[model samples]
Target: MATNQNFIGGFQVNRHLLIAGAALTGAGALIGLTGTVIVGAALASAGRGWVRQLDTPPSELATRKLHQARAASLAGLEAWRTGTDGSPN
Candidate 1:
């Protein structure tokens, strides 16, 4: 009977497989870290832009958005009062 030196009991341990697994694990970790960094940078940039917007008074566009939102809410209330929400007559 012939037995490999890397065999323990009845199981054989392959060095190449272990090395490949370790390399893949390292690559996955690096990729995850890079993605996290990119997302964090994008969030930071967006936050800064939001802060810059807040430093200025509301623009005409902002006022128009607010008015539009109020108008939509009023329209919704009117619809509710009129029972136009798809109810069986």
Candidate 2:
């Protein structure tokens, strides 16, 4: 009778330990996922700021170069339409 009681007690203790371990594992996984999501969001925000800076055109040199390239392309296209190589006016 005493041995039977001891066996039952041991079984219950083992069950409780298993449940606690599973809960801890689930909590750790949740924490890792949360950290990953936060890091990804921070990187995405920084990338957006970098892209915005590139698009803002804050320098005269950059604007001038862009205009020059556009003009050259337009001149080339016009020459092609008129069936001649572009030459200086």
RMSD of each: 7.4, 8.7
Against the true structure, candidate 1 reaches a TM-score of 0.51
Candidate 2 has an lDDT of 0.80
For each candidate, give its TM-score against the true structure. Answer: 0.51, 0.48
* lDDT of every predicted structure (CA atoms): 0.83, 0.80
After superposition, which runs of candidate 2 have C-alpha atoms over 4 Å from their true positions? 1-13, 55-89
For model 1, the stretches where C-alpha displacement exceeds 4 angstroms are 1-8, 55-89
Q: Against the true structure, whose lDDT is highest? A: 1
